[model samples]
Target: MVVTATRTALASADVLADVSVVDAETLARSGAVSLADVLVHLPGVEMTRNGGPLGTTNLYLRGGNTNHTVVMIDGIRIDTQSGSGGATCQAIPVGQIERIEILRGPAAAVYGSDAVAGVVQVFTKGGQDGFTPSVGVGVGSQGTRTLTAGVRGAEAGWRYALALGRETSEGYNIQPAAYPDRDGYERNTASLRLGKDLAPGHRLDATWVYSDADAGYDSTTSKSSANYAKDNRALQRLSALGLSWQAKWSDVWSTRVMVTRADDRYATLPAPGAVPSYNTQTQVDTVLLHNRWNWREAVWTAALESRQDRLSNAGTQPRDTSRTQDALALGYGAKSGAHSWQVNARLDDDSEFGQYTTGALAYGWAFAPSWRLTASVGTAFRAPTLYQRFSEYGFAGLEPEKARNREIGLKYSQQGHEFAVVAYQNRVSNLITFSGAGACASSFGCYANTARAKLQGVTLSGATHMAGVVWTASLDVQDPVDVATGKRLARRAQRLLKLGAETGWQTWGLKADLLLSGDRYDRVTDARPLLPGYGVLNLSATKALTPNWSLLLRMDNVGDKYYETARGYATAGRTAFVGLTWTGR
Candidate 1:
């Protein structure tokens, strides 16, 4: 399989860094309801949520900040510039996703800012050679219902695909202690893709995706003693559009031009006599121009990118803001005898934060026929978000957060068995954090670059297939701490374990997964009690009824364990779902 870790495509076997891929078949077999479900099983990945299904979710990769990871959908950046500068992973529908590529470790040298930890790219379903149609319906716990339909085809020199889906659930209470009412959520999604071959080696493609949701949540700002029981609702909408043209100019040269636009809008309505309603909107526009050249033993790529970010808020305190960024990147990869190497460098000039330069170098040696060793060092940075710089309690003199990273990996594979181990360390400086001391010690504190941190971790993973069954397991041990006070970073588990087994016989298939997380602190200080560790089990089964039909059943949180990823939040208990799908070709 080809991977996009280096911007230019490379074979998975030739990559010198840690990477993971989740394809459509794997997603379908897992029967996951959200993207977070699939990512938590991967090595060096952790997720924390504030509530149940529709609550705010955050992902931490290799112990980095939630905003440190960059998210992309079909070459379009989908990271939001709202409250905390992260992707809205819960709002994305898994039914429309065809594949996901995860590149672990720092990738800022090739992807620019917001890549302090790694990168996640999602690819949606594409057109096929012939006319194909599919439909699915499912009903599950908590009065949940789902419906999805899609059609894809290609003929002559044109191809097209379209998908539509909807989901609704009368969810359980997310904040039982403070709010005694049940929360409910509803969502609708649509996606479209179109492409055409202009000439022999030239093609043009366009894609668009839309999602809208309404959900009820708890409010902590009410004045009345029973105000927490009142209703508080939020409406969210997202839209992404992209257009690109790719051409193979010669046997050794290729070029591409692409443009993308994304918009995110959210509105919150509080109970009467409580906090006033507010609306926030964020929009991003990006343009990319790239070229690649191939040689006997090496490949080289260069690209130019430009982006514009805009935000608008309407409430008692209204504001409007915008910024622009221009960047250039260069990358090279080569293989000689038993050695492979890669180098990347980038320079970004932001209209707000002057200029930043980052680079990375990696080397891989195949000492033995079935053994490989790799080492890499890189630098990364995260530019200050608009909210951090211009919000009501913002600070204008914040510097960009920066980090230096180093990693070493070893891999072994033989006879359908594979094992890998990787160790990494990252030291970050000028970390931006909220402070209620020094210059801004008022009621509304301001964000300041007043902290430093160090993160180090080791991950081990292995997989084996035998006797019609496959077994996979992974373990991660990490130490992430703040340098000044020697305190563990909040919401980051120090250890994690994941195990899975899958097997098939005749027309039936079964899969089971187990995840374990270690205790973690919920705040920067030790004054707050530590959140206890927890484990979850998930089971799924699929049976094929005919050539074009199938049935799926899934059970989540089988043990019905009560746990909290974040303090004062609630999690789902044991739940089950049954679904049926039909396809035509």
Candidate 2:
């Protein structure tokens, strides 16, 4: 397996830094079978799921808001809808990913808005020399089954690829219920990529992708009702179209321009006696231009971007709004001897939230052949979403969330062994909250600055390869507190752990993984006990049956661990499945 962590002018292999790269092979071995499943097992990461196969899986990284984590595909932001702030990582299917590159720590200096937590970049697979056809089928616990197929190839001066996948499963309890779990889901997704060599020094690439999903949600947990079989339904649909052109104009300068558009529709229908269903349709369009220049030992990167969004909501309360934003960033970095230094600044002007500036500065020094030290300090800000700013019984003066962070880390890598640890603190102000979303009579105030939070944490992750086997582990310790009340914040755990190993022997493969999460208070002010510590185990094996085909098998949550990350939700139990894969050149 090979990890593609970063892509720069000088892209190198075997990088030693604060990062985690998941290769295609490793993804399959985990038996995660879903985007959210893969991330939950990573350190410092937690997920919230409504209940079902394609449920609303929201990710919280390093104690940051769900919208503070950026999702990118091939270096381009794929998230849409300013109201949602950020797209759900779980919306993307794993079958189309070639590799996943995760950059940890503050990245607002590079990306923007959502980089407060970090960045997850997904790169889709491309074509080889000849057409390759592949298919896979898996059946596991809870009446689960998945089927996927795809073809890839290169012809003429253009390379083209396509993939289609479908997945379904009868999900788990989600919460203690009066009846057996009655949640399940179905999804259909397809993606296409085409690249053309326009000139000796220029190229063009285009991608079109679409997904439609019908998923069930166990909405009973929200109410005190013991009738858990009452599951709502969610319909999610997304379509994206993008085009990019890259050209090398000279030895010292190069440029790339991209235009992208996305249409997203989300709807939730009540089950039986629930409130009337609601639906939201959002459209996002963006254009970005990036240019880089290298002058001797120093390099500069600058980008200009603009985005426009409009959303329409239908149901009990109808509303609509449109906003536009323009942003620009400039970064300078240089390498001298064994030290590297970087500085970046960015400015964003939003139609609804005024303007804000964010930036970062960092230094990396190599004192020894195999040891390096990095230190960074940065300031970042997130504009209040339209919903947070102007929803319902309005609070017109709400401020954007803001934070300042500082960190220092060390890295060491020799032979195939590597390790890194970073300690960081982020002081946040004006953290936005919807506590005021509670229904209010016409004469009462509905929104106000009700709370504030502080997040301090240390993250440690490492990987080692020895005797033809690779081992990896990560741990996160976080203390999230409500500064207003001097108490611990809600839904923030104190400890998180993950460990995994993979080995291959003469045409056979073996892998195992473990995930453990500690307990936390369910409410900040009330201090109610919620979830407890729990562990889950996953195992997989694969064997080559022929020159062009292989057989694979997996068991997920093998321990049948019963626990809830969310206050009232229960997770899935043990499940098993098998698949077949074929590759070609």
Candidate 3:
């Protein structure tokens, strides 16, 4: 079941929003080390990463800004008030995740602020009905090595899960033009979850996850020269905790109360020094009360949320700031005969930004036996982060960014064959952008609302099971531009095509896929320098040696393709991985 679309569990086919779900099995088969790698394969998603998997990573959903997409762990939001004002994708441990739900349009009506583009919710692995233990080891290109062990079990109305993982890689020269050095990265992760049924209709759950990474990168600062190397590295930590109590009053009503906290920390130090040249930390705390009711054939939802964002910068120019938001949201959904409808509304009152409201309306019609058409319209807004308004180079008067989106979709589904076509246009005003100093102390740039954007796109996707194989494909054509300049958004391609095929032999399961992307602007400062398009092919296969053991092989970038998502940073050209897993079933 997917809950991101309307803040309540619903079948994927019954949802009116454009959405996708990726399970743990898919993640394991993708042979990806980071969340960013897996996201790029989804429809209407674009990624930009500096250096390698352990670099500054950003995801653009439906041509929105990096911060426009709201990321949640379990049911808690994870956003930073420092450094780009978004979640740190590089710090999330892929091995600990059980599933991911992605919504590809405005979702501020369900989630509170900072969902101008959409929402992504990640669920960690938890205990099932039986005891299960697993251990896996892998070796990959660039001297990469990985080890993971996990266990899940349930007994006597109690459930528990524990997972641990570690990975290290010897990377290549990330930015040779600035400083020539072999960048490397190391990460360690751990996760824990526990749940208990206190009564016949009451239950409680708690979860915690933590990861730390040290990654190498070349700095563009004046501390390094073309002939000299400072050997810069970033130390990062990400952690999240969630506690919830769920109660079912009757067959028609249920309520849940949850509290969650997340923290993001980064310290960039040069020359392996004891002191960090730059250090910052951001923490988010949230409390939510959600209620759902089913009457007749309709579903109703109401929720109340309070969130706080805090930022701290420790150094010679130390600073600390915080802000809060309180919100109330309501939603309704119904399916009668061949027509379905969904509506949602939310109001957020920020400590600094006063009040803002958002709403969404969607309708679906089953015109034919196996065909459905959907139309939706929504509004969203994002308040400025604390760092953007209180830092040395910040503008105190920065305003919230606002957007309105309209979309239509047509779909056909029968048995295991499915196809869809969706078209969307989003117009954003009061867009927060960095420009010449605006009443700030720094000579560099400061954040301000000085731009408008138009993001329009079309997506065609299909999946089918035929001839003993499953095939899936998607194509995206988008034009994301600045209203005044008419220049395309940096690092966004105009066209992208992805194709995949999977099959199972007598003893082996095999998969193959390809990616083709169009050209893009190298930098946001200018669109003159265009980065050429490129294609990459990947292959994977798994063999069951025994009931308890299995072997996996994967080859990425099989054609040795060369491409760059960012101008100076080099991409991982080619890579191969082999793994062995032992499961106690």
Candidate 4:
């Protein structure tokens, strides 16, 4: 089942949207500590990181800007109103996640704002019928170590789950030209979920997650002075809490009320003993009331949402600023025989930017057995972040970014075989960019709505299981361009290809993955030359030692390929990890 695409639960095979789902089993086998690394394996998804695992990271979906995507953890919206306004991917822990869903294209029609690109929903571990306890320890290359423990259970109409994890790594020098020093990184994570069944048709739930991390990097703007090198470290923390009530009044009527809060804190340590700089804190609070009516072959949904974003920065001019948005949304879905359709509409009122409305329509036709064709059209928008409007380089008159999208897809699924081909075109107006210093209080630059973008792409993917082996492949060809400059978007490759195979031999299970990409430019201004294309391979194996124990061995970048996702940043390079896991029998 999938719910992110339409804001309601439904069979994934019949949904008219382009979406992907990932389970816990696949995540564990990948051995990826960073959410950015795992998301890159999905079709048309790409990411760039500055230095180590806990470094500043950004994810681009279908060629959209990093801030265009919306992220949620268990029902809580998690985003930062500072630093260009986007979700902090490095703060999420892979060890605590149970499932993930990716919804492609504009989703502002279903969700209110900041859904101009897509949406990523993460579900953490939850309680089962009985107590289940687990523990794991792992060691990897580069002086890396990890420890994790979790427990979940249900008893007497009460359910609870808890998870804790820690990871540390001795990273490599990202910029040997200026600062030849080893960068280090460390992180701690925790998650909790509690629930109670009040009656046959009512329930209550509470969820929370916290992450704290520190990472080292090098900063050198000039080579004229070797003393300019500084061992900079980034300090970051994120926490989210969600509470909800779900009631099924009858077979045809259901309702949910939820409230959530998220906090993000960030700072910089110029040196080992220097005082932290650029300290900032961002807080978001949200409330939602949702109603659904399920009757025969049709479903209807309505939602009322309210959100508040506040930012406190010791470095910015204003020091403190805030904004609010309230929205109402309506949706409908129905299926008759082999035909299905979905419609959504939303209206938003912002305290600073006034009002806006968006809508979407999607249709699907099952013309033959195990085959479906889909088409969709939608519109979306994103409000400017508080930092972009009240900081030293801010412009209070900047308009919200807007977008329109159209797409079509064909899919076939049966048994253990699945295939899909999708094509889409999205255009964005009032795109924000940093321009000359004349319009703002700062002499360096100011944020302005002086750009436009065009993102068009085609993606092909397939998977099949045969002879105890599973094969998966996907290819993406895209054109992401700046309409004003006619140059391609920075760090986005025009072509990407990925392949994977999994099988079992006796008690051992094995897997392999390969990724390839085309050449890309480092900046939209063409200030630097084009970066060359690259490929990397990864392999892993798992074995069951006993009824309650398992062993895992994984190797990444098996070829030791030297590549850079960003111009001055460093990749993880070749690394190996081995782990032992234990579970209560």
Runs of candidate 3 with Cα error greater than 4 angstroms are 221-228, 272-276, 315-318, 527-529
Report the lDDT tens digits of candidate 2 across residue range 2-55: 222222443332232246667787776655655778777776687766555476
* Between candidates 1 and 3, the lDDT winner: 3
Candidate 4's residue-wise lDDT over 238-330, tens digit each?
Answer: 999999999999999999999999999998878644444678899999999999999777999999999999999865667888899999999
lDDT (10s digit) by residue, model 1, range 1-585: 645588778888899978999989889877666678789899999998876665778989999988899888888887676666877777777888999999888999888888988998888888989999999999999999999999999999889899999999898887777757778888999999999999989999998988898888877623245545357788878898999999999989999999999898888888775467778888989999999999777999999999998878642133778889899999999999889999999999989998999999999999999899999999999988777777665666878999999999999988879999999999999998887743432366777898999989999999999888999999999989899988889989889999999999777899999999999998897675478999999999999899899999999999999888887777888999999999995
Q: Compose the digit string of candidate 3's lDDT tens values, residues 1-585.
A: 898998789988899999999998888788688887888888899888888888999899988888999998888788888845888888888899989999999999999788988898889999888999999999999999999999999999999999999999998777756656678899999999999999989999999989999998766522344434456789999999999999999999999999999999989877644234788898999999999999989999999999998889752134877889999999999999999999999999999989999999999999999999999999999888787777777778988999999999999999989999999999999988888967877788777888999999999999999999999999999999989898998889999999999999999999998989998897667737468898999999999899999899999999999888888788887899999999898
Local lDDT at 119 for model 4 = 95
Clashing pairs in 4: none
Ranking by lDDT: 4, 3, 1, 2
Best by TM-score: 4
TM match of model 3 to true structure: 0.97
Candidate 4 segments whose C-alpha is farther than 4 A from its true place: 221-227, 272-276, 527-529
Pairs with steric clashes in candidate 2: 174-570
Least well predicted 10-residue stretch by lDDT in candidate 3? 221-230
Score candidate 4 by TM-score against the native.
0.98
lDDT of 3: 0.89
The C-alpha TM-scores of every prediction are: 0.97, 0.93, 0.97, 0.98
